[model samples]
Target: MQSSGTSSQLDNPPSYPCEKLLVKPWGWKWRSSYWFVTFVVWLGVATDLLVYSMVIPVVPFQLEELGYKHPASLTGWLLFAYSGGLAIATIPVAVWSEKYDARKLPLVAGVVILIGSQIMFMEAPAYWLMCLARTLQGVGSTMVWVVGLALLCDETPPEFVGRQLGIAISGVSLGTLVGPPVGGGLYTRFGFRGPFIFGIIIAFLDLAFRFLIIEGKSASKLRSNTTEKPNNEIALEANTNSLTDIGNDVDVQNKKVSFVHILRLLFRSQRALATAFLTFVYGIIYSTQEPVISNHLNSVWGLNSSKIGLVLLAGATTIFASPLSSWLADLQGTSVVIIIALVLSVPWYVVMIIDGHLALFITAYGCAYFFASGVLSPLTVELASVARSVDGIGYAHVYGAFNLAYGIGTTVGPVVGGQMYDHIYKGWLAICLLAVGLLGLCVIVAFFYVGEEPIVQSFTRRIRLL
Candidate 1:
């Protein structure tokens, strides 16, 4: 009986499959390393964003070649189709990630879809086929982002969550920065096929990296095998630590939460709803600017695809500040950082409305982008905190909701912004003022309703006691 029990334990280790890998001289042992997982996730996110954004500047030109008379409306619909797919897929993917043992599979599936979408983009002769391609890309993006982030939170120490998320966001920024220039430059020189070819290469790299990732649970099991303690005892201890660590934020009863249950819990928390709202608003700001700015550059300055991409490089530069913004959130709290960033955005909007020179336009847009990055960098951390505070174990679900908000905004922003520009070509100044007013209101809501204590508040309390 003793021998049989020992054999059973060896065959079926108590740790999750993510824990450890067998240590060979080389081979798959690298899966057990934390840096490997982090790098893979970072690259995955960057590549996903890169492929998506690379098509943006080239969309107008592509539509013209495809024989579409009204490219503006078509462009908005195409953008909307992608975000609609993202929003629709977010919840289902989140639930799957939460329930499944193999988190890497979703990532692999996503990359496969991405590759397919790129192929469609390159070869599709019809408009509907192109829209289908963009929608598939969006679905793939949802899978990668939801699963990748949940895996990152699971593997990382709680204290490092903010910093790590910041790094991930920086990767996204880097992709956005590079995509337009590369896509536009390539398309200008080599036509539509050039950008899609480059995207396929990056997608393959993303796949290989995801396949090699080993989760923390698997790594822990491998380490347990080398320890002096009995295998069963090590398993028990590891399980206990994991439960204790997660218990603070997640009720034991709610461990196996359903998708509907996650929605209910999210709405019940004021902070979660507030964060979701802000994410929605941020999405609007991001998606709205893309078509508007691209169109503006083409119409006003008669800039070609290559030159438009150069102008966009200004906005991309602000993404470099993501680490700093995330560190500030860790130190000062997300609410404080969000409020300050929104306040700063007001003046930038005013500058944009003035519409002076090309240099001025780029400067205003860059400053606006910098503030937007500040909001995005820490937004996920704040959402995670809210989930924990509400006794929720569904990190994937929380982020799924955040993405849903963003996806909705992306879906709506381009359509509305595009229509507004079409009807009122000279009405951008009025639109800027309206956006500023809305941002101001968000700041007020964040200050009053978003419940986290800022670093300044903690200092004040300590001073009062002294």
Candidate 2:
């Protein structure tokens, strides 16, 4: 019989990627596992949005408490500052991520930034300082959103990417809907410092999870022998380094392009541009509801804090649509799903304009929320598809563009909507009209450009069958 020492030496061990280490990382299995990675990304996204919005209801009151006039306007500008930082940081972050192929580091660094911003927001006394803190928060938020989603895409399968992304995006629905209530609840009980303190705690948890994730590529590298690599390992490596290309009209392997050039070509593709516009419009719909609509509900309907929270909570109930949207995207094509959602949502936006019907208004908001949440998955999946079609473009790059579109929407939504609401009579009408117009444009764009073939051609073919 072999001795125990000989038996122990016979077992093959995975070598770490580092020159120094001789074995797989401790906790590598869970740290690099698919579900675990997805959960981390989901939490990463939820944490960012949770904290970003945790102080939403409280911001106006905080400003008023600090003796600032026109608290609504100041709140809008603060959101503008956040969006400004998001817009400004996206490109540089994208470039660096692509160049380095590192996600977790930036993600950790981002959470740290978010923590600092929360502390600043909690302690700052002046309006400009608040703006500065919000801007920093935006920067931190961009890091998580762009890189966290990219990391998810990296770990997921090609066919299931849409569905998986939809699941992750459910975190957005959770964070957005839950944050204000949680914040409002804390405010009711504990006053000014309550929300920020909670935010810091959640962000710390996020930082730890982000630190724990071992990327798929790195984990794959731990296999010292090619024969020892499993199918999953092979698939993961293929996602990054496969010779076979999908898109036509370019030699993907031989033709090298700069990030800017790849981005230009991506935008030139009607499919990508349409999806980007859809994301932008979705951001507008979401941002319009927060400070603007919440304020409207309070001012017009005389809603107390609890009533306002209930309305937003009602809106979030349809988050179930996210999974259905993802499945529809994978099955029928994302373009079709987006088109259907946008069409169904139009009436709801129109319905929100009616002032006399609280129950009806609540119904409209919930319907609108369902469709809005549905739209995000298809847009996310579509953008990833676009990036795959082009050579030298990565998830990081496209997601940066994604963040850029969202930034513009969030920035313009509040600033312009707030201005119209504050300075103009019938400003609610203007905001409604604006949302309706953007939705109409998105519908047309998706019909023409969001699919493998224009949806009108499919319609024409179907008509012939009839």
Candidate 3:
């Protein structure tokens, strides 16, 4: 019985099982390097949140001042253009990184952003130049979104991958919490250049960190070049094959897969993409809420920057709950946790739509987002695992799709919400209703497709509301 119990534990491992759990191990240990990579990648996430949150609130007003009425269309296009860059670059970046290294991409992107910001400073009067600058930032955004995530997957073991991802995602949440208040304050005080200046400083810092702290060989194939190998082993291998034979073998191995091959692989399996579609829908709603919610408070409630920042800060504080969400993902599973999170959001949206007082509104909406982002992390982890299973190179493409969904939401939300505010309900309720309805759709999708497991059983058995 004791031997059987030990065998069972070995077969179905605990989520946090580590070096101490196992008696025999087959691989070299590198905990310090893993943590270092995690820190650097987390910083990259910080850069993304800081830069994006900086511009979103102010972009519409900036465009409106340029005598561009009906600004929503232009805003939509600008966001789409940024996401478009991410989409177009995703597959190509993956392919390139297969033959090269991804470590330098973030540093390169930071340099571009710095130069772009400086140019924006020089050409502040031109609207098109501002668009160009944003596009350049988008290029860097794509790199951080893809490469940083891939590194997380490479660094952690399978059981702990979800938790590690949760930690990394928390950085983005921290940035979200910090960026808006800082940007809004700077905008209130320093005018248009405030956010851009902040981003430029962050870009420089990110570049320096990437160059100085992160070693290339730790995360790249460059290590393979330095490790010593037996000469006789190499000679026996070379002697076993003719030059032409070796060339043919290499050619066959390196043969590029067709786009259809990739599509088929993803659709044929149950991996990230299946779960990612749900996330794509959730992202649309979540992205729309950010700028629109703040805009609503400012336009309707007459809130100042400090008050608005406080409102946003309330929502941002939900980040503190991410580790708890991650724990839930481990104890249950991502699929079950996602369903619960989305279900909780539906009521939050309903509350946001109806609540007139600032305190009540922030409390309700913040609670929703707090739970919503919790769901978001597990969903991303499952999606990344999906891509990793399908093809080692498809991770960025998956993220590109995810980003594209967010871009769509951010792009459309302002325009749609603005139009609703002006024409339909003449209140923020329309946008809130839309968010509620979309979240409802997500719940329906989850019920039908999120699947069953130890995860589903645990959720149903432990947290069953039905």
Candidate 4:
């Protein structure tokens, strides 16, 4: 007969292979895993935005340094090149990330690309080299953004998505807040090389954070004896009952959807299409502000790069409002929050039109940024909801399409805004009017097409019952 110890060993099998069960790192614990991943993703996004914005305040000086006769037009083209690269890379990266079942690799590769682009920017010998650098930067940005966001969605619970996304947006705002001033200050003291050195340092830091990220699947495999379920299988199982409860007819649980089919389904939902359009317009409004505000400070106010950077700081302050807005979206419904934000934005734009003073301009733009921040998180939450309602496999593609729409807006905004600024009378007024019209369209679309029950109706019903 076998000894008691031997029999006990055979009876209680190991939960995981000996080699795989070595030790759990700090991030691998189930309790802290999601938060750690979210923080890393947030850092990656902040670093991308930091690097992108760092170049903005100094663009004019760089053009002049390179002896360009028309820096204004080239600036627009430079912005276009970046957005074009992003538009080209986003969908491909999204598809790649989905197929691989790991976002960590792509995240690292993107940061590596970012580091190389910054080095090129620092050492660029010709205008073409700078353009090439910007394009590479855009590609890196697209990879990070698309993969990072998909990863976040994959890890996060559906109920908390809006708040989590809001937190991510705040991280972005922090980067935007810090980058311009730091870049401009560095340029003022040490010229182009300084900001790029700073960028390289941050890129490495971001890479380190990405390397430490452990996907939930990998963690589960380490912690359990049985082979873990595929992430898609888990996601489908989790969503099936909710989809059925909502009266969804898509049958996404077992379906393998093509990208084109995903697109078709999205378009068929008027709500989804409207969300996409609003996202596009939101991109236009924000991207248009960067070039226009920088140019306005330079040409109209004769401000130095450092002062312009300080002025831009006003916009970043609005980031603090993101969590509050996200909470409001969760409580009041995303549609109601969006409609209220749009209505509030009109007055801010009107104020901008009426005031040319530095203080007034800063205040108006800050308020505009505050309202704009409210739109992004809610809209993203809505888009994700719509995509899941259509096809469980379509979440990654939905985000890809959102990025594509935003990329197109980024390309169009600078080019059109620059041309209008150069050639049209009261060009600022024209841009503001366009913004108003776009906001009106979004409000109408949200009112009629988006399927959320009206917050007002819900409140009224509760009151009637009482």
Best by lDDT: 2
What is the C-alpha RMSD, rounded to one decimal, of candidate 2?
A: 6.6
In candidate 2, what are the lDDT values of residues 1-466, reduced to their tens digit? 5777656544533333433323567788789877887788778788887887777777777777778787667788888889888988888888788667779888888999999999998888777898899899999988877888888888888887888888888788778778878877787778878888999999999988888999887777555432445444544545545443344224533454577787788778887787778788887867765657667888888875556666677657656777789889999998889999988988888988898778888888888878867888888888899878876778988898899899888887778777878887887877887888888988988888887777987889999999
Ranking by lDDT: 2, 1, 4, 3
- C-alpha RMSD of each candidate structure in angstroms: 5.2, 6.6, 11.5, 6.6
Q: Which stretches of candidate 2 lie above 4 Å from their native place?
A: 1-22, 225-256, 460-466
Give Cα distance to truth, residue 342, candidate 3, Å: 0.7
Model 3, 396-464: lDDT tens per residue?
A: 555645555554555455455555655565456777777778878777666555543434455577776
Name the weakest run of 10 consecutive residues (lDDT summed) in model 1.
Answer: 17-26
Of the two candidates 2 and 3, the one with more favorable lDDT, higher being better, is 2
Enumerate residue pairs that collide in model 1: 18-215, 18-217, 18-218, 19-216, 19-217, 19-218, 19-219, 19-220, 20-218, 20-219
List the lowest-lDDT window of 10 residues for candidate 4: 13-22
TM-score, cand. 2 vs. native: 0.87
lDDT of 4 by residue, 6-124 (tens): 77756664343333444567646743376776788778878988888887889877888878865656777788878888888988887766655557888899999999999998999
Compared with the true structure, all predictions reach lDDT values of 0.79, 0.80, 0.63, 0.76
Error of 1 at 297 (Å): 0.5
